[model samples]
Target chain A: MGLNLEFMLSIIPELLSAMVITLQISILAVLLGIMGGLVVGSFRVIGPKWLKMLIQLLVDYIRGTPQIVHILIIYFALPRIGIILNAYWTGVVALTIIATGYEVEIVRTAIESIDKGQIEAGLAIGLLKRQILIFVLLPQAIRRIIPPLTNELTNIVKASAFLSVIAVNELTKISNKIIYETFYFFEVLILTALIYTVIITLLGMLSNFIEKRMFSTNSEANS
Target chain B: MDISFMIEIVPRLLRATWVTLQVSAISLMIGLVFGIVLGVLRVYGNRFIVWCTKGFVIVARGTPAAIQIYAAFFLLPRLGIRLPLFAVGVVALTFNTSGYQVEIVRAALESIDKGQIEAGLAIGLTRWKTMLYITLPQAVKRMMGPMTNEFANLIKASSALMLISLYELTKSGHAIIAATFKYAEVLVLVALFYFVLVQSLCKLSAYLENNVFNFGKTADPRNEFLN
Candidate 1:
């Protein structure tokens, strides 16, 4: 009934293995999100009128709902609509959709942050729209955007824990399995949480370091 | 997309929306109180309390809210800590939201100039008095904008309460879908409940951001989407 060291030791091995699935889903989701966000965000920022409106509407719809709702909808609702996604695809697709909403905002803001004069200079130098974006705006925006984008990546990692409810055998669900078997509820949950804390905090520290370095370099280059 | 089904489910969902808000509202008030305390402690308490509060935030931020909900709902009964469903929802959500709100408040407090406190002491104010009178009011005003954003997030997050068999808005939609087999229609309408709630929250956040910064000075538009 009390904290069992023996049970804790036994369950850790299982939890660590389950953590692989958690990382697998989160990393995959984030990668897909970045790619999707780059394309969609770029288009939304500078694309034609109708496409911008369409993506804007889609982003609003995605933004309004919670991540848990998205996972539930993807897993349950899609099958009825004659689309079947396996657990892996479901995790990737759903989390990517949510990630893209935030990532697009990050990218849009990053692009918008570039001074308008830089764009004018690029145009004056005979650069095309794409060349101006790629050559003039993106380099600066990438440095500024790293912190928020990393923050979103941490969000995806946390969101992976929700995938347990859909029986994804991620870290949280694996802990639930251990809890039922060992009745070490408190020990198991704490241990599971510690792993996530370590991962997310490391990412946060990395983002802070990047932001600080970028800030100093930007200031230096300006001077 | 199944308008008749939506019409039929609307009333039931609306009723559950109140239940959901009750959970969020109660938890948010409790969480805000806890947040204010923890926020101050993190900023000005002795090293131990500050460190302990960091541990609390670490746990809250690291795991999913569902895990907290599960521990509160399922494991506690086994631990001889029995609570009603509503109480459990409030406890779990409040615990989780406090972890976040404390960060918001602490950041607000940190942004204040340290020289102001030194100035207060020069004017014969005690350290506690300096904090209470000189620091907290400004922090709370700036806190309101981010606080509203967190409150809106809290409401949206309350949807996770569905897992523990509580009929909050998200769960209410599931109940309707389970009975009527109108999954798409019920979910669409359910999404509408959330959309309207979040949009209103954004408006409130914008209002607070504009009107609450400084001694009624406007916030910088460059940082408008910041939080």
Candidate 2:
């Protein structure tokens, strides 16, 4: 079938509106995931043995199972348990949980990469363990964590497409709806992909720019 | 929380695990073969091939596998190309994994020292021979960890096959829970099965890394602890 520009154009506004929902879900999920990661990562490092083991098991389970499976479980199973969440919230919670697993690893690695001498120096200079972690270690670790965290954020945005399966009217879901309505599958799908490409590319460029700025400042400080 | 219901479902879930493994294993094998070729083209081919490879990787990596599976299952039939859900799942995942694997293999290839290639050439080995003998062996060694990790990722990603009704592990869990209505218990069990499988793979990869791929002897102790 030939492409239909007119049909595609008519749906652009609708798709754009849907893209806003996609953006909201992506951003909120990333924010919540980052907060969860901070707690999980910190616990992995310093929590009691049982707590650390529990957190590690949580991370493993999240990492091992697919996000799509988690989405299915949360979307389908939660309702039966009397915790009825809408599709969008279910999508957000599922994505956030998976993202937190990955982010915890990233955060933990970034923290561990900080030289041991710095932590020892802070401790020797009268800082408590918590004080050193908050003041000296995390500041340095956060700088290192930014790049991977941004990559994870971009990944979370792409992963939001899975929400379409559960009937979230995100960009991909709207495109599916348009395709069903107009039967112009290729044209509409291509347009949706182009829009996603542009957003993800811009996100990648912004992260690279931030990385450059941070590294330059880091080098200046070292010098 | 009815333990007996879960106990009864164990046999069914075990049968489903076989399907999940079949899907993951078949796709991983196919993807690795395709990925190596794509990686070679990516590293050595002309600009047009490079761009095409990059486009393949970007589209696959930048989108969810569910959409790709949907496109494969729903859109392909509309274009007069019909396939079973199992075939569609395998093809879609092969395409997906090859995208990521190309990058991994390309990096592995590039990580080999330039001087090694030169030494091979000095011995009168042809370009192809040098790549086959010297470059590929080193690349394979360096690639073991990443390849194993990707394999683990593919196993998890195969869960997306449920969208097309493939009756894999997750789908089987959904079926069991649908009947028994024990949502949390069933899902937690499903998650446990996945955890055990993936954690074992991770530990296996770590063992391979330490024993076989220990070319870089300056290993970090923390990594050992984490493993």
Candidate 3:
């Protein structure tokens, strides 16, 4: 039989509402990722040499693996150690861990992109390291980090769908439930895929808008 | 956390890693071919072809790999086309990986100087000859590093096949945990297995990228880890 568009249309509202959970997870994970990444990433940049090596190992180990393993490990494995998390935290923890690794890369790269001469000039003018970082380095890095950071936001939203495996009732999980009932399988999947496409495309557009507004005159920021 | 459990699990995990590599390798090969065709279509095809290729890339990339895998594993059988689990895993990955690969090749192709192809044609080279002799060689050279990075990415992304109960590396870990009740320890070994696999691949690419493709260039930011 052809795709039952009637079933598909009926499920659209439920799927859209479930997207709120998906967005929630994305927001939470993105915020934690930024905060944690800034901490780990800044330490890597400015911390001692031994600390840099340790953090680098941590970053690589986390970044080297897949997010799905992290989810299974956190949700399933952690309970063996007496730390049981319900469905939601497991996804957030895994996503934040993954996103944090990426953010570390983004921050490390952004910070490095700033000219050493600028920092040296700040030092030459008798500013402290902290003051120079606040005044000179950070302003440059934040702008540079925006494009990649938003790129990570879309990643969080996308990867958050994996939470469905743990019964997190996010967008994908909710849609899967409906598909189980209706067997309007292709139609449901297409609708779900379309929702994700719209969300990601909007994020892309937002990044473009910000890029245009922030980098209208500066040529280097075009990237 | 038992030492014997970890020891016993290693072989099965290694075999599962082979399965993971199999999927990634086949998909990477298929993706490389389709990705090139898609990239070429963006640059040289008619308007409808360009739109169709771009639409594929956008949809493939925008959604999560897990959802795509689920849709394929669950939705396709209803249309009277039942694929083997291995085939399903490979199809999902090949489709997903090709989208990203298309972007990489397209960027490299577009970056070629306009004058080079014109120069080739000016010297009596056919359009096809220009692509073969001039355009593709340079684009392929520049694409080596990114393509290597994407290959490692394919291996990592293959872990998502666990969602559909495909018995890859990650799913192998889950089986170990289920049988042994050593969740943290088994999963640790599983993570280590993946880490070693990914690192070795990265090092291999970095080695080739470092020695052969220097082209007198210093470290690009993306290539810094290679050196």
Best model number under DockQ: 3
Please give the ranking of all candidate structures by lDDT, highest first, separated by commas: 3, 1, 2
Local lDDT at A87 for model 3: 82
Which residue pairs come into collision in candidate 1? none
Q: Model 2's DockQ?
A: 0.51
lDDT of 3 by residue, A106-212 (tens): 88888777777777788889987667767877778888888788889998898888788678989989988987887677888889999999999899889888777
What TM-score, over all chains together, does every model reach?
Answer: 0.93, 0.92, 0.94
Model 1 chain A: worst 10 consecutive residues (lDDT sum): A214-223
Predicted candidate 2 versus true structure: per-residue lDDT over B1-227, tens digit per residue: 77887787888888888888888889989998988889988887799999999988888777667667767776778789888888888988887899889999999999999999999999999988898899988898878888888888988888878777899998888777778777877887787787787888888787788887675564442342211
Q: Highest TM-score among the candidates is held by which one? A: 3
The stretch of ten residues in a row with the least summed lDDT in candidate 1 chain B is B218-227
Clashes of each: 0, 0, 0
- lDDT score, candidate 3, position A216: 80
TM-score of 2: 0.92
Lowest lDDT 10-residue stretch of candidate 3 chain B: B218-227
What is the lDDT, from 0 to 100, of the residue A193 in candidate 2?
77
What are the chain A TM-scores of the candidates, in order? Answer: 0.91, 0.93, 0.91
**Residues B100-137, candidate 1, lDDT per residue (tens digit)?**
99999899999989998999999999988999999999
lDDT per model vs. reference: 0.82, 0.82, 0.83
Which pairs clash inside model 3? none
